[model samples]
Target: MRSLVLVGHGSHLNGDSAGAVYYYAELVRQQGIFAEVIEGYWKEEPSLRQVLKTSASTEVTVIPMFISEGYFTETVIPRELGLGHQGPVPEGGIARVIGGRTVRYTLPYGVHPKMQDVILARAREVLPDLDRPEVGRDTTLVVLGHGTTRNENSNKVIERNAAALRERGIFAEVHALYLDEDPKVGTWPERVGAKNVVIVPFFASEGWHTQETIPAELGLTGTATLFTDTPSGPQTVYYTKPVGTHPMIAEVILQLAAEASQARGGDLDRTHAESWRLLTRLAHGGLRVGEVLISPYSGLLELRHMLDEGRPTTDLLTYVTPEGLRDRVRQDDAGEYRPVRTFRTLPRGWRAVVDEADLRRALHYIYPAVVEETRAYTCHSLRATPWPTTARRQTGIYAKVQKASSAQVEAVAQKVCAACLRTRLWAAEPLGQTFFDGVPGGIPCAEACTYLVAAVRDELSAEKSPEKQDQAKLEQA
Candidate 1:
């Protein structure tokens, strides 16, 4: 079957790091163009290396939902897929035989010319006729990036997009600015030669750069500052959210994946089969993944959400479609955003069931690839990352968690992970904690999660603070 794995640079500290990817991936999944649509992240769960381990597609395309072509698009993503560029490169990207399967890797999603459409859409949200030369003559459009020397063409995308936008004559001036290098975004006041400025951040998601750093650099109070005081008299500043958030980008992904698929040489026979057909085999019998219970009785396959296996489905909210099920699981009973879907607080008394053909779509809406991965783990074909290695790979604010003593990790997991349903398989490995190899009939967590690591970092920082230590002593006394 055909499947697509969209990789993005997720954040350990911000749950919204991959929001755009997840949101659009779900949209694409609903379209059913690809048998399976899954997400892999460089900084989150279901890592890039193992994303395809449980997938059923023999012919798959790996597309990075990144806005630039550099270290990530050129090297990191391919290496994670074990491509190593050993074979001849194809039109879309490098076509490599990975895990004995021919997998096509597409270049980063940002290089296409169609991306200009999404940026223009974002601009229209503030100024309806921004595309018209009459209305855009006095406006300056800034295409921003974290420009670098990592690759010779590192700044090509932003520069190229900027040049293309300028050619459209939609704005008086278009400047490609970077945060990490010269002609930086912070120096826009002096670099951009226009009174009316509009900055469109070339990022895949809203996180540190889009939400914090960019706003700080531009001195924007909100999305639009009308006639604000600036170096060149009072000029209006309009800041559009990252283009990835625009609805049109999801359509962009569809075109890119379709293009890559056409370039791959594969046995088309049975390639169009639903990727979730694997779930149909177990439809006759019940299978459990963590707290989700899948049962077949009375000629109906029922997938229920509950805290305990002993609980009944009485008074539970029932949903029959994947979309409805996802909406329910994205939040806890308290109506707070439940970023980690496997948390023990998984709103109890909820049920979802679709035909056997759509079982994977429903299950993946909540648990992702957990069911298939669990089966692989049971068959001894899957291995969990050791706790130390899992901790060491954390980046950004969570990287400090690597310094956490084993005892500290144990204590933090006991508190933070105590409310999650995911079996901490890492806990059973070397240098691990007390013991939780996970019981049968539960989803296995191959590595530590952001939720647990954040808690560990907090506790470690608290212990390091003399004031917090004094307060702890006071409480104990």
Candidate 2:
């Protein structure tokens, strides 16, 4: 027999959290898709671990009813169910043999393309009188999610869904607001700028956040239509039940289960593949630079020169091992020099030696605007300090850059570039730059100059591109 387990992040404070989980479990059970359809939770009864232990089926599928891939779905759920390491269940699928039973894990349902249909259906329920064509012109749809400071990954799917809805022009405007993050629920009146506002909670169930906190924050007496005054004018705000409570969600769960069962063993391995792929044509052919490879065993960073195919040279071929950088050197075939394969341990640093050409290529590849703007800037000005380190330290820099006015972005860019110069990260020669004389005391670990260029470029890219913003939201979520 096969079993299906619907796992939810149950609430300890209220019974609402697990309501939809149990509802869907029973709904699927009635379809007779599996011998048993059970519901499990992190905080409530029939805990994940307990349910898995007592299941009678030899095979089981655990589908997380989450809006995005985050801590709970990636860690707690997998650990409790004994599904591989306590981290992201592979993207393709996850099947593990544990305690004589096979468990297949599927990705969160929120990312599925069909989910937009469900969201649209939920919003339409609140605006029954509004025609399909008039929906976009008259109503503003707001997707309210329980954003978290702990894991930005929690809100990716919600933001993606919101972006998709906006692109479709199905509403006057589509805005994604968070309970714990930015675009606060209280400011919806002015932020939405629409007389008719429809809010749909992007939660798996009607928990405390959806049922109590959201209502209080929005100044709602109940789920019924309420009139509120905003900076613009008076507006009508309509709230609906959580998206997960919709009956159509049962079909989504079954679809996810079917997908996992089909991809069971073969593609699951491919799902755990690396996120970044460095193609040979791009690295060696187009870029004409060294190839960056990862060590299979230790996952260490290795830089191999394209010119020296067989022979390793100290020129640029180096690997960052656990201890330090291993600079590979090629010796003569004769007895005069050391053996052909020899490596010397270099001091631990970001790069063995910064390559100007490589840095330019990387910057242009990652952020073309950065390269175009800084064309006159010499490599010396750009090479002094670590750009990657500085960029990482400045969290949310992309949003800061994006939100800034046209004048503000330029002014801020000048200030940032000047600061980099003062810190010795940027050069002062070409522009008669007399910003700062010496480097700052607490300079971070120096990485390849190209990496720093790439980092800054990425921020600029994010600022200029809306699609990049959506992608960033997905990543951050």
Candidate 3:
């Protein structure tokens, strides 16, 4: 058993980009694929450097969760991971000895054949639901990938998988579409020439491309719909989850490591023999498996034994709490404990109160998105149950605004909502068009940044005040 690091080129603009990898990592950890499974991003917290450093396993494997073997995998990741050149560990970047540990890197996840199986499995999930008996043999499956002019191979991988599916005679036809170049998504309806189409994204993860660009370009106002406009009679469209997240993905990762180890004259059966037990543990939710390795090297089990005593870093926030003041005490009363005060703010002219218990409950129930009648934003989705609505905002994890100006409270509510939105909680729904439609008050990125900046400004202003000046100086000293 060794350590596994799945790295992604995350996006600041689309929170789902990171969400995809994190969810997958959590699943992998739950399955116990490795003793230590970490999800690192280029844009978010726990950067590639930090993830690698924090991993306690002596033998480690790096898996590029990217959908392409282009710039990021060929150059950026190799240079960053110190995995050397396109061939071995010497041509790309620095190779330093860290904590007496040895690390190996593998190819991008998309290149693995097992991933092809994942694509097919995901396609099957949506195809059956969207397939029309009336459409019959005319139905087509469009396998969409975030094709790039910079990397023709990206589209090629998707196209190859489409061809494979077509060979199976599962669909009347299958085709590949790109986001960057021609054969675009808008042209899909024309190419398919079928009354029904099931579109499966070959992306490694979900993000803006899947949630925003793909939907708008394909004239899909909603997911899984039937359209009769494209000269193909009635067309039913269905979009499936990205290929990287399918349950079969873990098996693909194992296949890669097994094959790589065998190519080096290592016994594939011997290598996989130990992996079978690990895989079983993973299947049974083995998050605490001692010393797991997710790489392609020959010495995985030894590495696992070496890492036996090390504590896992996956419990980073097991006992974490939300930041900020939960209550404002202009006129404190001991009886307030019956419900307890919650933090709230007004969006327009509306003001509300949220009880403390209700606020705590909302942190769990209103996940991914929370609809509070007016505005909504992304938040770092918290896990808590939803409480009943008593004082408007008091029902959820947020109480109504009290003792503070409406502007001040609105700002706080917006921030809380934004955090929820980012965490995929908005109005008790994930704040994406694919999952939730008609977001009354859309949460734009600029507004989120403004709210964050304003919050910091207010905190600094309060700290600079005479009341807190002495306290701030003392802390600084």
Q: How close is candidate 2 to the true structure, as a TM-score?
A: 0.52
Order of candidate numbers by lDDT, starting with the best: 1, 2, 3
Preferred candidate (lDDT higher): 1 or 3:
1
> How many backbone clashes are present in model 2?
10
Highest lDDT: give the candidate number: 1
Pairwise TM-score winner, candidates 1 and 3: 1
Determine the C-alpha RMSD for candidate 3 after optimal superposition of all C-alphas: 19.5
lDDT of 1 by residue, 1-477 (tens): 687888987755555666777788888887978867888887665567667664566788888888767666766677666787633234477666666567878877778778998888887887777766676887888888887775646588788888888898778888888888988887777655576788888877677788898888777889887654556776777898888777887788888888877754444323223323445555557665556677785776788753545566566777878878877776677877665666776776788767775676677767666665565565555577776876765655677988888988998888877777666777854222211133432566776765676778899888879998898899999
Residue 252 error, candidate 2, Å: 1.4
Judged by TM-score relative to the true structure, which candidate is superior, 2 or 3?
2
C-alpha TM-scores of all predictions: 0.76, 0.52, 0.51
Over 4 Å off in model 3, which ranges?
A: 11-16, 86-99, 129-136, 260-477
- Global CA lDDT computed for model 2: 0.56
Ten contiguous residues minimizing lDDT sum, candidate 1: 429-438
* Per-residue alpha-carbon lDDT of candidate 2 for residues 291-376, written as tens digits (9 for 90 to 100): 22211122222333333333434434343331122112212223121110101111121232223223322222222222212221
Model 1: which residue pairs collide? none
